[model samples]
Target: RDLCADFECEPAEFNGAANHVHLLVNLPPKVALSRLVNSLKRVSSRRMRTEFPEPARHYYRANTLWSDFSFAGSVGGTPISVLRQYIEQHNRPV
Candidate 1:
């Protein structure tokens, strides 16, 4: 949430499962989505590595903590409640 605020975005909902996370953020038109994602990955990766050096070293081979690709979509006419439920309930493969 703090991270989103730093990028001028509001995190409507967030959840993590398996190897991926779901985040429904409200972004301003001027904010670059790619930049925000990269910043989030960089900051979190650095902090996590500092807190858990052994796991970071053991699990990562090329010092890469995040994938290069990301998915972005508009809420459009969807209800916020529905989006929140989906994020909270959906699980991904490891």
Candidate 2:
């Protein structure tokens, strides 16, 4: 939601395991990768702290939700069908 509103990026998929999450987003050509990442982390952290106080308190004592590092890559070279299939298959079972 925030991504769409702020960055004009559409989030296509989101999946997570115990400790981390994978997000697949379609960003406009004008958006910078570093700026997008920082915005996502900041907005998500703030929203999490406000919405889930108990978990946020336990996990983020310093009021920081995400780590300083993140991983991002380009999927433009690959076909969208292949990427979507890979993400779907890699998602942890509920």
Q: Which residue runs does candidate 2 get wrong by more than 4 Å?
A: 91-94
Residue 44 in candidate 2, Cα distance off native in Å? 0.8
Q: Model 1: how far is 72 from its true place, Å?
A: 2.0
Worst window of 10 by summed lDDT in candidate 2: 85-94
Off by over 4 Å in 1: 91-94
Query: Model 1, 1-94: lDDT tens per residue?
Result: 6888888899888787767888888999899988888888888788878998887776565767767677877768988999998988877523
- Tens-digit lDDT track of model 2 for 1-94: 7666588889887776657777788988899989988888888889888998888777785658788889998866788777777777665622
lDDT of each: 0.81, 0.79
Clashing pairs in 2: none
Error of 1 at 89 (Å): 0.5
For model 2, the local distance difference test gives 0.79
